[model samples]
Target: MTMRTRARTMTALLALAAMTGLAGCAPGPIVEDGPGEAGTLEVQKVNPADFAGQSLSYVYFTDGPDEAATRELIASFEEEYDVTVNLEVLPYSDLVTSVQARLSGGNAPDVVRLTGLTDFRADLLDLRTYLGEDYAEEFVDGPVKGVLGEYGEMLAVPSDLTLNGPFINVDLFNEAGVPLPDSEDPWTWDEMIDAATKVQEATDTEYAFAIDKSGHRVSTVLSQYGTALVGDDGAVLDEAKAVEALQPLVDMMADGRMPRDFWLGSGSRYEGANDIFLAQQTPVYLSGNWQVGQFADNADFTWAAAPNPCADECGGFPGGKYMGALAEGPNPALGAFFVQYMNTTKAQQKFIVAGGFLPTRVDLTERGVQYPVRQEDMDVFFADLARTPDLGYEANSQPSYTGASLELVDELALVVAGEKDTTTAVSDLKAKSEQLVEELQP
Candidate 1:
């Protein structure tokens, strides 16, 4: 398949909360804000002197049915502004199509939720003119890049940026007598291997890392090699870079750097990678900053994070998940409003404290987004995100990312089952991927 095919839905990613109800939204699954107590996202408020009267429309993906906190925010915002936002809520899957249809039909809502590049492309409002100069430059490229349309016009604003780094079980490291590195000093892949081996040997744990979900595991490895499973266009990928990124995991597993039984079917839950690190089953797990919540929730262990390992030449483990907007919305005005609203330091600070998602722009992170973990650890997570995150577009960005990444099923199974060496297996896959990218680009 071509890159275009791989560009969308990498999360399974993509979603906008509200859209014109005249049409429907994704019904595949919706995560509504549950009965988890109504909590407030600390809002960065403006002094009344600088505030203006403006009503806007907002569409959001409810954790599921309407979330009380979201509704509460809507009420609060409405009371404060001449801005009357017509709120539209919808399912995740249908969010894009429904909003596109509404905007095409001249009924687009003012603001909508967004996922990847495609959403921000096409016709979303550009925030460059609005912010002027100083404000825009403060953010890192990862968040800003996701916000653009065709011409680098700022489309949507990011509320948070998800970044990955090594989550180290300090207790395990200490027990094993392994020297823990400072967050500022990142590990190299070789150093990581030695350290992990030492940790496992001393503790008798079966793994140095766990693969609860391979999302973080795979992306960082691929970045080192210079290929990604998806391309900038959001399409299926086959590239030399991808081969480089993936080879080490195969090697690490073979060398017993990780648990032998930790492949996809190992029953490790998707959200539990953090728990694994905490339990000391693994000494190091590549994880995102959103995990600040898990760290905050855990008190028994004295764990901390280190920056993601980097190759000698290039730096940063690619990050995933930045917010954006749909080009065509039922209401462009409201869409633009949301774009501007969400990216502000105030909104991001709110997301940071509650959800543990790292604020994308340097402006917000610098101000100290809340987390219960050590100040030094939080600094490491943000540095990685700002330095390097999201090396490739998500599956939806390139439709083929999911399917193409999936194509390795047979070949990977071959290697995993011991039928092939890491070199031979990846070599064969690399040829196919290179051919595929060539076909997609032309």
Candidate 2:
């Protein structure tokens, strides 16, 4: 399709057209407008003729609607710039390690779509120099901080931002004659369970609650309790708050409000309770926004996204996929330019719609990308993302966090299995995390 034709098609796909903002990454504080407002941010333009005939290699992993959107964007880039972007797709499990190995071996691809930014920091191309300082400033500070190097270089442009939140079976709540909590007035952990219990019992559901078996998902509870695996000092978890977080999970499992088999059923390998939620066996599922597309596509029953329950505060863990160029890539100019190209206002709008993702750019966050489906669910997720505490980003940004988080899952599994008490688990986790942070220090 011609560029004009394609742009028109994308516009037709959304109920609203995102307003074009001031060009060249205008410097200013983001005006806090609701997502309903039109976005007013534009990407700093790149000269299509600058890298004409240049060839670049991009290593990527394909999943969800993003893969198609990426390929479409790339096709446009190749046509406009006369650049040949050789795309190589890999399995998500191996993408990071494979790219790291290539970087370590001094044979990195020109660009890569990465989830593990801190792991590839040394080899990541700093786009700030190429894309301009104002361009980097347009992104949300929290997600940007997660991908930046210690020297504050922009390692990647964050995309497809993901946040953890709660999903409920609306039918179950109605059947139980219980009212759902207002989004403005969120429920505490106990209050949420109390409501879920009533719903479960009234509807004859097997469980009141089910959370995905992920350290990342459980961290939402930690965040709600005002604690994180990584604190101001590296590898420090607040023991009292950490115990407070685990106690609820422990109590629910003991009382059968939550299914013990699901938590204990999956050993150390990551698992999710989405299936149970889909089967309508549970009244509530504490998962993330990534499930929205799947649920919208296949769910036979009515469901809705709800405000996350609170403890010390209400929030979810912040994380997202990122696009970056390699410092060692053969075509640094073209690679960096392509990275900048992906974050353009038009590109971001197309990406989120295709992938059912939340936008990472501040302008898009304010302007809002209207999904062709599930607009309300996306709104709840956007609000939950706003509630994410600074520590959520900080914890994920730590290089050691990946290893520490894996160990965290194992430790928490022990706590649920009665192999270790919360106090002991917290202590062991702190010690192990410290070791990991030291080992991963650059």
Candidate 3:
């Protein structure tokens, strides 16, 4: 209700209050915190009045997170800014293509959405120019890089370094009589394949591995080799390195270790065959973090997170999501604000609670938020994310690199499809990828 009333609940000085209203439900109370929690929520401080009477259009990944509270917060911003904030959602695949077309056609949303690694690096306005001096550290580490151009300049503020990974059906493993690994003993590649093969042999499954040959899935395999899809030279992965990089995975398929057709083919239901896993037809799902919300909602079997299996030599893959800001928008400030807003500790709490996205902020992960109903579930994801090396980020593993890295994926498809031998595929991929990387390199 009243700000003063909200203040009574906080321990000390109250800088911000988040009031939520659910549809067809009574307006919920505000959650207020003392100083530094939300980094100055006082409307007077940021001057929501500055945004009044204006409409801000943000082009985002067509749709994500409709948590009533976030919408309520947007409404409050609208009321404060006196402007309508229109969110344009697009498919993850097409978000960039859409942004580029709009910018060229001059119909671009004021705010643009970018993957951590997929979108253009130089096209955005320099956020550091807007948030320079001392205000920058208030943001997370990943967003700080958004300003960094190809040679390293801050092009835009970061949205989120969303974590994506393998989803395991532990109950299915148990049911199929495959031994599940302990929390300490993460599965190795051979072990993962063996377990999947065993599950198929022991059950009436159509597929063992939840084949996803997308570059997203390949990141994990690349990581398993301690090889980043984009190398230190910042060129397309050496097709040789790319091939050698993904050798273990190709071998797994070649040896009849995992399902044959599912990954190498693009026709699978993109929403996930998690249903297959749910129905006990496919036991594992190699998917993004967003699927957690979907999984908890539909899964009937008792599933658990297994440390993503890795190559025998290297450890697990370091997962970094793609996110970015638009070059132009109806509300550049607010678009920037949303980028900041979504990546904040507060939003991360909601992510863990709502979508199971891993927090990129080390501080948040170490001192986790209490937003999720399933703390245990959050804890497991947090651990899964923590095991990843910081080197992945330093290696420039932003989701933005998805396109350039995909040259290798195209080659992998040929390998698995029997169109090309693994050796030739890797060798050819290395050459083509090197050229692409040279073109994309900073």
Candidate 4:
């Protein structure tokens, strides 16, 4: 058969698997004896046999650490089911826009792996029926929030959770004679800043601390302060706390505790301070779990995931990748089944270990992942993830949060650059958030 003919046949076979509306020939004689007269034809009920030679398309972001493991999982699924899945890889920046465009144009792929769900929620297939209630309840609270729809339907399953926390140069701390705090008794933000400042001064480093120029990472600091830039009601819950959360960052930039150029120079685009930390020029780096694998391989000095520092609370922001099926796809049923397969305990455990990812599954979170490298550092991040405040989840779950939060980052950057005061910047953020909420509301 020609490749084009084979493609058409595979598409029809997969569509017939779950759709009761499609009636046609397959490999041959898929129909069975049913309750109908001799001259009449009754459509056979859907069954697994319908998927025998079917095909599916899945979109995957290329930024993940365990691309090979993910492909292995897909290959296993295809081998077991005698089917095929076309994996379309895109960079993280292009994944959302491309998928959303396809969705709007009614050309979405069968399955997709994504981070933000707000824009795609309308197009996502509800997997509650296939995944079941008991299975859906197995996810940890914060990670699960990222996959739920407006009405609490499970539109996607979260995978490879990330948490924003600090990593410290253990060698620098030891060099400065500053003792790192024990895991059992973690220090507050103030104490952490003091230790970092001392280490920077003693070691003659350029900066004591550095954080990603991202609203998402900054939310970690905001959550510790018992607030977020935008609340569930599309406003700041504690305006005073929002100001307090941001003021320290502005001050840090001015005092050389942080690199002013990193924040001010990046404009509104997301930027990281990983190079400075990896070069041993900074005592502390405020990043996330995703960096562990990279740092483990590249950092010259001994580094470790530090205990999350507290202000009013002790935690970091929660975010993750999500696997979902597009409702408009040719084979949503097959797509959903694949999503379930990926979320199975065996698959999740392997993916976690291979990628050094924090877990979204409750059991995995409790049992832990024994990464081949830097297991202890991974433990610190997992510990902080368990303690993440609800505010972090609520703030990000808002449909307007992504766009508004980007604006918040740019506004705060103006404050860091001394172009705007904290009070005015925060007020502008609240106004911008409210405006976005109105514009984005369905």
Candidate 5:
């Protein structure tokens, strides 16, 4: 059947399930029915024939290359299990709205992909109940720890890992006669600005660097300065540390080294720094490993990933996408099976090789990612991930800090637009973040 027809069919099925109260069915204890032992990753214990007529739905938002790889995997799964998967693909911008709308209507998909699983923990099924606790050991600690729900529930299975850093145009540095920073002895934040200024002076580029319009990217700078959004007690943003972290960005904008339009302009947040970098209007782009495939295909000039600059310490965001089954979905058993299937060693290897993502599995790391091109650039990102401090991981992983991290992005935009000075912005942000954390408390 055509994809559109399958989607329509699934929609009708979901409506039926909701009306019949099947969508709210609580899954019974998992009973292994196949030849292989239960809860073992080595064999498939769930019989395909048992779910032969079952139809499932999934929602995902991913980049071009990852999307293609997912489609291939879904096709293989459908053929093997004789089940139909109604995959609804959306842009990153629309993913949250679409999922929430479906959920409120009592028709959430059986499975969904998300970057921040903790945000939806209440609606997600605890995979540990079905997959067994031992299965969690297959993945790396950072990715696994980031997805844990309150009360220590395993809410999701990580699909791939990513590290945030900078991508520089090698050609721009060569043309400007600026020596590249040594990866072993990376440039400090001040040194990064100096190098960028030299390149802008020697070339026609409008800006020296383009930071991704994200609070998460800005948090990397905060981490380097030893300031976190949350401390042991609650939301914490030291005034001095906040200014020290934000001052350089404000200065760069005033001096035309960084564009104000990119952050405070009419453009949407999804319009990333890649545009300026690809246009050769900026010598450096601060983003993450997710851009590897896009840059390999589109960038016309010589470029490579670099270790993020440091103040007191080197840091980068340790993040990745995860797959989870919804608690209110029609079939939790099938949903859990599909989530685990996607993370199998063979499946993960194929995804990393095809999509150029860092592996989340411990064994796959030793095997190494086999990028079709630019393996050295991938190595830089891998090294950055290795050296990332514990605070960097905690900033992204902790549930209490999620709201605060998002708020920082807006406050940073205000500082860039000259609406608020760094001191006032940080002070305002601390108050707002504390309120958010209090509301989340039990």
Candidate 6:
């Protein structure tokens, strides 16, 4: 099917386009205007005719609607510039390892799509010299920070933004006679559990909640409880906060409100909870906005995105991918041009609208993109993004947090599976994370 045709089909499948409120703590001051208002700089634009016959290679993962949108962008670029782009699409599972192998072999693609730039910063072309400092201001702050290196180098161009929260089975709530919380009034952690219990008893669902078995997803609870995977000095997860963050999942499992086999299930480390959710075995699923498209296209029951339950505060990990030029690539000029071109306002709007993604541009966030489907769910997601605490942004942007965060997930799994008590698990995690952070330091 054509890209536009597929988008239209996805839209048709998404018949529930009603706006929903998202609950969370208030956000810090944010720039509500477009990046153009930030500033302007006179930077040299790429003259496509300068290298009409030049060839460039680009690599990226293929998934969902993005693959089609990306190909459309490449076709437009290739046609306009009169250059040949050897586009290499890899499966999500093979993307990172393959890119690393190629880079190690000194045969890096001219431009590549990356989710995190920190590890690749040393080998990435610093774009500030080409795109100008002013150009960087055009994107949203959270994503910009994610692509910025420790020495203030622009390692990548931010292309999109995504945030995680709760997706509720609306029909189950109605059947359970539990009132949904509005954006103005979000439920606290205890309150959410109370409501989930009601839904479980009334509906006899196999599980009340099933969170994605990802460290990033679990970090939302840690962030909401006013802690991060890594602190300013080092790894600083206190026992109290650790228990406060992890105990709820443990308690839910003990009460039979959550499936013990999902996280601790007999499967690979990559096992997911999305299957249980899609089967309607769970009333709530804690995942990122990426699931919106899948739920829209595949769900047989009514559902809506809800604000994350708050403890001391409410927040979620800010995530998105970026396009970066390899410093060791065949053509730096072409790579830089493509990176900047792909993130331009027009290009971002086209991709965001076509791919059903949240825009990385502040202005696009405020003005909104014309998503072919799930517009209302997108609204709740944006609202949740706005309320996310600055600390949450800080946590995800740090490279050191990567290893520590994974350890947190593994250790927490042990706790959930009753392999280790919360105290022992937290202690071991704290020490290991601290060591990992120290080892990662330059």
Models 1 onward score TM values of: 0.69, 0.88, 0.76, 0.87, 0.84, 0.87
The top-ranked prediction according to lDDT is: 2
Candidate lDDT values, in order: 0.54, 0.80, 0.55, 0.78, 0.77, 0.76
Better of 3 and 5 by TM-score: 5
Ranking by lDDT: 2, 4, 5, 6, 3, 1
Q: Which digits, one per residue and each the tens of the lDDT, describe model 4 over residues 239-287? A: 6888988898888899988898888775789988899899887999999
Worst 10 residues of 5 by lDDT: 34-43
- What is the per-residue lDDT of model 6 for residues 302-411, given as tens digits with 9 covering 90 to 100? 99888888887875667788889987899887788788768878888988777667898878877877777888888888777877877777776777787877787788
Q: Is candidate 3 or candidate 6 better by lDDT?
A: 6
Q: Tell me model 6's lDDT, rounded to 2 decimals.
A: 0.76
Off by over 4 Å in 6: 1-46, 266-268
Instruction: Give the lowest summed-lDDT range of ten residues in model 1.
Output: 13-22
lDDT of 5 by residue, 1-442 (tens): 6545644554454344333332223233221222122322121234334666788899998766777888889887787667888999989879888888989999889999998865577788767545553466888877777666544456788888888899898899999999997777778998888898899889979999888877778888888787777744567667688789889998898788898877786433444788889999999889998888889889999998888898867857777788999878898768987887788888988887777789989898766776788888888887777777777666667666667876887888888888999899999988987887688732
Count steric clashes of candidate 6. 0
Deviation from native of the Cα of residue 185 in model 6, angstroms: 2.4
- Off-target runs (Cα >4 Å) in candidate 1 are 1-57, 62-75, 82-109, 123-138, 225-245, 266-272, 313-315, 318-330, 365-373, 386-414, 424-442
* Model 1 Cα shift for residue 204 (angstroms): 0.9
Residue range with the least summed lDDT across 10 consecutive positions in model 4: 31-40
Estimate, for each residue in 92-177, the C-alpha lDDT of model 3 and write its tens digit: 78876777787788776765655553455545653432333223455456435534543333455444445445667776788788
**Can you tell me which runs of candidate 3 are displaced by over 4 Å?**
1-48, 62-69, 80-82, 91-94, 116-120, 133-147, 150-152, 236-245, 267-275, 312-331, 371-374, 394-400
lDDT of 1 at 99: 73
lDDT of 2 by residue, 1-442 (tens): 5555544543442212122223424333222121122333322344446576789998988666788999999998998767799999999999988887887788889999877676677677767545554556788888887776654456788876888999999989998999987777788888998999899889899899999888888888989999888744787788889889988888888888888877786676789899999999998999988899999988999999999998888878877888998878898768887887788888988988888888888899988779989899888888777777899888887888778888888898888889999899988988888898888855
